[model samples]
Target: MTNRTMTRRDFGSKVITVSAAAAAASLAAPAVLGAAKARVVVIGGGAGGGTVARYVAKGSDDIAVTLINDSPTYSTCFFSNLYLGGFRSFESISHSYDTLAADYGIEVVIDRAAGLDGNGRTVTLANGDTLNYDKAVVAPGIDFKFDAIEGYGPDAVETMPHAWQAGAQAKNLKRQLLDMEDGGTFVICPPPNPFRCPPGPYERISMVAHYFKSYKPHSKIVVLDAKNKFSKQKLFEDGWARHFPDMIEWLPLDITGGVKAVDVASNTIITDDEKFQASVANVVPPQKAGQIAQDAGLADESGWCPIVPETLASLQVPNVHLVGDAIIPGDMPKSGFSANSQAKVCAQAILAELASKQAFKPRFRNTCWSLITTDDSIKVGANYEATEEKIAKIEGFVSQADESDEVRAQTAAEARAWYDAITADIFG
Candidate 1:
């Protein structure tokens, strides 16, 4: 994969060379740079990748960071549910990497990573160019297992949008909602356990129901859930009855077979007991680490990359760290907040490693919010501690499982505030 040339579309603009004077002027305090400059290659410039690049570049002057992603702009999946529910526009979730390159001095490359040779510390891009690095951080996010369900693949998504990754799919789903007539059925199939954002499916249903209340009051949402219990279930259930009474219906795994098959053209979903046809269907398939991670030999048979808890460095490969949805941090939900928290810990560890210092102890946190309706939200949050082999949940840190009017109101307010704060941490 070496010696590959990059086209204009592949690499975007060439690196903006900064003179020694400019570089020196931009340097942080003397204490920040504890070692000689080292090149850090970060693959995937989304929530995790972008945060790591910024932190590494801003945490010390001695690190030259480069972020490689397939897209020039990233639209977050965190707040994307709101977009699908028609509460926010697509522009609100979309973000550019220009600021990361120019303001933070990160070399941004809009190229897909084809493979990683961790032993050699080199990453091969889709265009065949190979990037050598002192250390590499990978946060390639989630990939759908289309085959997990019968008659469903990338092609099926065109008619029935999952909108799981946001961007175009989000728009597609939104358009479908608008096209639906009154009294139409909107089917939502949430995947099995251990997927990105445990509370996301419930939140999505809430948002969609919110739209129905005003525009299509007779319309209903049928949730075909693969799990018996979900994050903040009681809160979401209560909010649904309170706000959109009878508009939202949930079919647990016992009755639905968790949506085993789908006929997109016919809008038919085959369940255990019977088949269902809907005007619109959103099928969130089972997921693993992104294909790039699996292709790079980072993923094990479990479809996730495992890492040393303290540094997030791959246990299979030295000097290469895996973060975000790609890595299986035990007991942690794959959410943007988890990725951001892990990125900060990863940055600290990388800085220590660059200076030939002891690894920094890593602590991770995640707070996931679900909108039960426009005015009501439920939340689940946790903090974690890293051991030598695995990351475990810290005692006494968990989301409220019970339902209360006061708690729901507080969560709704905090959800909006958290979105603003987290986005600022990544883009601002």
Candidate 2:
């Protein structure tokens, strides 16, 4: 958790390709056209939108770019778990968009994007102002399916925090954990497959266990998962067994019965077979693309937006692109790294289309790191290329189960370095 261990050497090659700034500069410029440059508008100023706006605007002064976000600052979901584990403070993960406006000359609008008029090629904000654009990029993250769970909704978040979107929910979850008494039971109800950050729930459990192990040794943690297996299942299971054997228990779907409901008043989760009592509950419900995507007609029946892999343009709406947690990215997990990588490809394609440049093959990469314990970390990543069919995975790497302590420590350091680099790349 110390900055001294996070060094340039620890990251080496992995951090080099994560940023979009250089990639934007490397794009081939179009032949001198006397025509007025295209106006591009980006919605939701998080990882995807921020990177796209920065890259496209910084790539060329001719193009007029406007970035619309509901808030002036962004809190990353990628490293929020580290905050719970006492590795980082909330302020450390929060970022502002001031540099994007000042350095890149991109107009930053702090307003909620209420509607998208694809037919008219305009984005309407909640304040009654409209932005007309030649091209649009929508990267609004996921929205919870409150109806998926019987007793948990937006109101229930006050008691049982999902902490999936970061910010206040994350702080609330941390407060709940700190309030629990010694020997109290903590329950984590993870969502099903295809959710954001497949390994996130397990990582949260690891962090909670780490916190309890240091202070309340008798505290117990239970994972009530909707799926039978999870990402990096063996690595997580191995780490749990090695570090906190009797303190953590994992109940898969079949074993615990599917989650039927929750009784928030009693701090209990109800399954088909039995009920789980908890001093605190972390219920991660099913999710879908943010409502704006659905309203814009970019999302399909699956409740996720589909995109042309090479250009990242929306399949249903022309000149509209979708990225981040809202898009159905084949062979890619919904992580901040994936979103930033996708934004680069998306930005390049947008600039090329606007400038009438030749098309090039698109390549993408993503690496997700999870801290199993204080100094023990694991990672899973892959390199992908766009094909006629889908974003096919070309190669992959993951932390081994029986790796040396030195390797694990290095991986943890690499994760911290990545967080620092990626946040700088996206925000600055």
RMSD vs true structure, all candidates: 6.1, 9.1
Segments of candidate 2 deviating more than 4 angstroms? 1-35, 357-359
> Clashes in model 1: which pairs?
none
Put down candidate 2 lDDT per residue, 5-75, tens digits, no spaces: 11223322222231346435544222233344457889998899999998888776668778888888899
lDDT of 1 by residue, 184-261 (tens): 999999999779888888889888988999899999899888887887788778778888998988989977667878
TM-score of 1: 0.89
lDDT per model, in order?
A: 0.81, 0.86
Alpha carbon lDDT at 363, candidate 1:
84
Candidate 1 C-alpha error for residue 282, in Å: 0.4
Clashes of 1: 0
Pick out the ten consecutive residues of candidate 1 with the lowest summed lDDT.
1-10
